[model samples]
Target chain A: MIIARVTGTVVATAKEPKLEGMKMLLLQPTDASGQTAKGSPVVAIDAVGAGLHDLVLYAAGSSARQTEITKDKPVDAVVMAIVDLIENQGGISYRKG
Target chain B: MIIARVTGTVVATAKEPKLEGMKMLLLQPTDASGQTAKGSPVVAIDAVGAGLHDLVLYAAGSSARQTEITKDKPVDAVVMAIVDLIENQGGISYRKG
Candidate 1:
């Protein structure tokens, strides 16, 4: 999963029935350099109680549907975890690494 | 979907087969108030060309696998669109609303 920071939230009164309780978020694309990219909103999931400004990792597709809250909710992306650190072969490029 | 901002992207030498050439972006979770939340990485499918600080929309699960580039990949999140604006019952709380 790509590292990201929380930006904002969205609300929709007119939507699908199964999507009632689902939490959707708007995401800005970014790279490892911590630079933003060109993109739009992402109706992502909030599984781990992510708040604004926190860096997080999100998932999508059928796996998103696999969540207990999102099952059959017409959802695609779901916030699965909150990142405290990130490390790799590069050795401690990011921490919380 | 919640509104989020793009933070960064990722590169992995070891990954799934169907994920070759797929663009993955890092996202930060946000609320309607434009606040960041807690979370981890979000390896999303990039459809629209979104840069840093740009808002984007992403999908997940089997639908992410439905993409031509991500078919059968182990990926779960995919960036589907770049949001220019977001409007709702609140009467344009967010713009580009």
Candidate 2:
């Protein structure tokens, strides 16, 4: 799993039928340094209810389909959990507002 | 999706019940350069029949569970397809033997 920040939502009108009710969000991968990682932002299926700026835990690969919302779907990434707090290296680095 | 080379197999006798009978393999992520990318090797469940040294296309996140072999399983990654040829950066970079 990777720590990411929800940046925005993705609006797609025409998609696979299985993805009709799934929420999609734009995510920026975050490293331990709390800086955005080197990569273009990824669009992920939102399994958990997370708002913009929320720190989330996301899974990639077949593991992503393990969620209730994504089961048997074509989603490549999914936000599984909304992070409450994070301790990086040694000290507490992030906490939900 | 990412292109990866199967490096080896993983044996886990004790694991989640959902993971029983799944073939797990070690994967080294490859970039467009055909070089191993920076990151620790990942253990992925093999949905397609892939052998050692085989270049395969793998999907991460909930999409991984979309395969017949990984449906509802706890696998995080899964090998989905074998690569026949790769045209990267406007050049034919790799061709399977």
Candidate 3:
């Protein structure tokens, strides 16, 4: 899993049949501090109802399909957990608002 | 899954039990042309006998565990297929050397 921030939402009317009604969000990978962007943004199915600017942990590849809602789906990424806080080296790096 | 080139090998004597005896290869993500480097290099279990400098396709996360040798393992990446050719816009962009 990787830490990311939900930056926006995607509205797709035409997609894989198995992905119908799934919520897709734009994720920007973040460092452990959850503030700075780390890599390219990716589209991911939202399983945890995370809102914009929310810190999240997402699974990529087949692990993204492990959720009940994404099982056997063609999706390659999923927001599996909403992060509450990030601690590194025994100190708080980020706290959700 | 993504396209990458097997750049090198990794020798590990201590690892997760399920990953014992598995060949780990260093992979560098590539563009569709398979020439330009796209992202940071990653370590992936070689499932298709990929050799050094071989252009290959690698699955990430849980899909990496779908292979027979890596099933239920802690590994997050696997080289699943060796690329024969990469065609984009109806033209060959890359071919195995």
TM-score of each: 0.50, 0.53, 0.54
Instruction: Provide the global lDDT of candidate 1 against the true structure.
Output: 0.60
Candidate 1 residues B18-55, lDDT tens each?
66777778887554333455355465766556677666
Q: Model 1 compared with the native: what TM-score?
A: 0.50
Model 2: residues >4 Å from true position, as ranges?
A1-97
Candidate 3 local accuracy as lDDT? Answer: 0.75
**Candidate 3 to truth, TM:** 0.54
Every candidate's DockQ is 0.14, 0.11, 0.07
In order, the B-chain TM-scores come to 0.76, 0.92, 0.96
Which ranges of candidate 3 are over 4 A from the true structure?
A1-60, A63-97
How far residue B24's Cα lies from its native spot in candidate 3, in Å, is 0.2
- Clashes in candidate 2: how many? 11
Taking the tens digit of each residue's C-alpha lDDT, what string does model 3 give over B1-97? 4667788999988877888889999999876567888879999888778889887766676666666677778988877666666544345667776
Looking at model 2, residue B19 earns an lDDT score of: 88
For model 3 the local lDDT of residue A35 reads 79
Question: In DockQ terms, which candidate is top?
Answer: 1
Question: Going through the candidates in order, what fraction of the true interface contacts does each contain?
Answer: 0.25, 0.23, 0.08
The DockQ value obtained for model 2 is 0.11
